[model samples]
Target: MKIGVYSYFIKNQARIFTALVLTGILSVSSGLTLIKDARAASANLSLETSSDVSKDNTKSNRLPRPVANAVLQDLASREGISTRELKITNYNQQTWSNGCLELPQPDEACTEALVSGWRVVVSNGRENWIYHTDSNGRSLRLASANTPSNQLPTSIKNAVLQAASKRLQQPISQLTIVESQQQTWRNGCLELANPDEFCTQALVPGWRVVVSGRQQTLVYHTNQTGSVVRLNQKPNQSTLTPVTIPVSELPPPLDRDVVFRQISSGGFAGTTYETVLLRNGQLIRVRIGDANDSERSVRRVSVQQVRQFLRSLERYKFTQFRNLSYPAPGGAADYITYTLTSQKNTVQYNDISQNNLPSNLQVVVKAWNQITASAQ
Candidate 1:
């Protein structure tokens, strides 16, 4: 009896399935031979059935086949699992953003914005892994699913927060727990290190807790039992000392003893406005138009507020901002320049956003803007 083409195709598919089942034990060459044979059989079926084979060809061509294969093989080897045990759940071409990397110390070269890359999500039944790769399929990093804080037991959360508070040397009420998540901990080990011996066995499970203080945000890493393993260093508080500035750098036409000149520029083509804060808490606002046309308004700001602004200026080390610049995006940039002067020193810095500014400086800028807007 002659076997029908459909029957032969079904039998061939069963054989390919069995070959896949045995892939864990099969040699790489043997596995490839089986795959090649399966493809040849599929091609033969299309020829006999008069069906369009171009669809099959195009489907195979759409993905970066070699890259995908290499990723599967590498992941399986690292995980000590069969390739068949891993399933590719999702994949897409991605453009790298500023925070695309989640590694402890990401490659500096890969941090460029708008770079082309690929993100592949794979799973092995119980856990999911995400692989980030460059356009050339070079693996940049691997991240696993994080257990959300809400899902964690309340005791675990409390323990972690307590540990964080102890590390920060602050009371629990003073520190705010920003976030917590369960993640695989490498304990600062290399990604390519032996997973079984170093990373997985050494630090299999961990939690990352983030807390915010008055001066900075701190990240803490802890084990499953909520014991602190590591924490990031605090911001450089030693540099917060006061700075002296010369009186000559103040904008002209003001009193010869003016100590601070805050020139703010905004609107299209950069309109100018200025605020002069003297040493005795007196403030003068000047609005300038083209050709040096100007109007001045005067007010006595509270000594407390003046002290706060001065303290912020010193804390943020604004004097260090001289010659620092940020390119403004077209039609959307506003510039703020703070020039502080005393009898012996002068410093000026300009930027478009408060993100680069210290928290105290940010508050000072907001207050200055309010005062300027009122004068307008």
Candidate 2:
């Protein structure tokens, strides 16, 4: 089925926005929890450093130059937008489907396909990340938002980025030149686009291209500095927006040592299914097969149902079990796996049996622990 432009942006924006919120929430929590104990806790809360400069504790890793440039160029041309106006809220290098950008227009044929396995970035002060095909599902866009940028609606960024990514001809590294500038001075003023320039970077006040990664020469701009300058000096916390917390960003309790005390074994077998259980995030549930079975039945359970079940089982705090099967005698057995956010819970069910258990329960527990660990 065909989707609309707004719908397309909304879908992708939701993914990026949800992650941004989660990161903010976690950063805040970390600041509150750790800053008191750590001497340079303030530095810890900052996420401004480029992902490449491993020196700072704040920045996410940088994307390869080719991919980062592609995302920038795509945002400029396809979305009829520019990087200065765009906030690198996220830079995820994960496998995403092409169907995401296929928006329904009055003319369905107008829809287009994007590269799969791309990085997704949430536009600054927006909800969704512009996606591209790269990285092990890690984001390339660096989230550096502030009060001024946050003032804009997520839809605006989505609309602009969607338009930009749709028309990308070549990656950013190949581009002859790249530039960023601020367009607006007033706080309440809306963003004005001027295609003549790469993009009008006016979301936040004192706006400038604080960080630029190019093939020939990298540049980093800052509010204190006026224009695109050399890529020197580490990105400081002052360059970023005060982090806000999203339920998704918070560390999952499942990651804690308490979550995996004793997991025997587990595997996601059979069919796979994903649903928009959360207004923001996705809930994926998989059905496991019996030991070496051909296939397992899969279904998308409600987020509410998953939450209720988890809450009910909360009394089993710190308890861990793997290969625990709730049999469906005539059908496949059900194995339970779950991920949670403040807004929703995702549950996965698979047909599983003792035989499917790994060589050691410790391994299973560790695997499960990793899932939660990554979330945290």
Candidate 3:
């Protein structure tokens, strides 16, 4: 009986041990699951913190409400879209080289002054637009405007717009700048001269501006400045051999640096006067007998100043005067006879009421006077 009791007690002890072991195994498994859940929660918290930090940084980089709205409103107006669709993506302070933000329209004069401004980038997710603005957003300019393939400079496009408006007798608002192609026109008339017109056969760098309006597509050819625009249309029963001024007849030294000399004689004094202009902006004058005329008084101008003068020569089509002689009116022999020489050709003209000088010659005469006065 006592042995039976000992065996039963031993069996009970074994069952208790099993139950404790099972309990320990279940406790370990639950602890491991709790640890995994805690680690996952920690990772989630870390991810949330990182996301919050990124959002904070992005917000910090955002622009002020007014400045942002200014660009957005402008672009929205241009695109005919909602302001909410526009987003300001980036911006920074910049000092522009000139009042035109370093993007001057061809021949559009920009004030030579530094401007403190901001360059803001706006976007519609797929495409981006750039803008330049003063600090307070009082003055703003769109640097990246509408153009698909070949883009004309802003000024050139505006010029074409104006010209097309006049040619079509339509308002500017109805016109659209569609396309541009760089072209080298074969003549001064941009190859659009009338049958009876004569064109200078010089290579003219220009553009073909395409516009769409009133259910009609119009093509216009223009010089770089859009200063010369011609419409392409059906010929008006006109056909003829084109007359051209040969390139050889084109004028001088606006394309290169060279010397220009002028000799004056046959005035009342009958003394010879010679003036020399060097590309370096030096002007020297000499006379045959008069000490005042013979003594060299030099006035030096900047290279840019001289280049501007040369541009005037080109702008006035001074080449037309090449090798041409304009004599004093029949009886005005005492007038000063002036001879101007360039590397390519010589031109002579005299001062007499009856001598009809081409208006452009006055541009050169004015320049000569300015230098000669400083020399005197």
- The numbered model that scores best in lDDT is 3
Residues 1-376, model 1: lDDT tens digits: 3568889999999999998878856777788999999999999997866656666766644547655776788666444356998888888777666344433221123354565667888887776767766666654555442212324445555775676677767777766554455667655431223336555445457765556554445665666766445564442332121222233544444354464676666555566777687655677877776456446668776554554554445444343333223223346445655553432234444565345444444565565555445432
Cα deviation at 83, candidate 1, in Å, is: 78
TM-score of each: 0.28, 0.17, 0.32
Residue 305 lDDT (model 3): 58
User: Model 3, range 245-345, lDDT digits (tens) per residue?
Assistant: 23464334422444567887887778887777767777766776775653755667665455556545545545445455554434556788777775545
Candidate 2, residue 259: how far the Cα is off, in Å: 27
Of candidate 2, the 10-residue stretch with the lowest lDDT total is 317-326
lDDT of 2 by residue, 1-376 (tens): 3568778988999999999999999999998877576746555555435443565533344555666666666544323344676665655445433333322211123224443454557363543444544343332332221122323223332332232333344343332212233433332122332335354344544333311122122223323223222222343332221112233533344321121112122335423321122211123232333355433222333333433333333222111221122222235434542322222121212233333332232243333444333331
Worst 10 residues of 1 by lDDT: 235-244
Clashes of each: 4, 51, 1
Candidate 3 lDDT for residue 33 = 100
Give candidate 2's TM-score: 0.17
lDDT of 1 at 192: 29
**Which candidate order results from sorting by lDDT in descending order?**
3, 1, 2
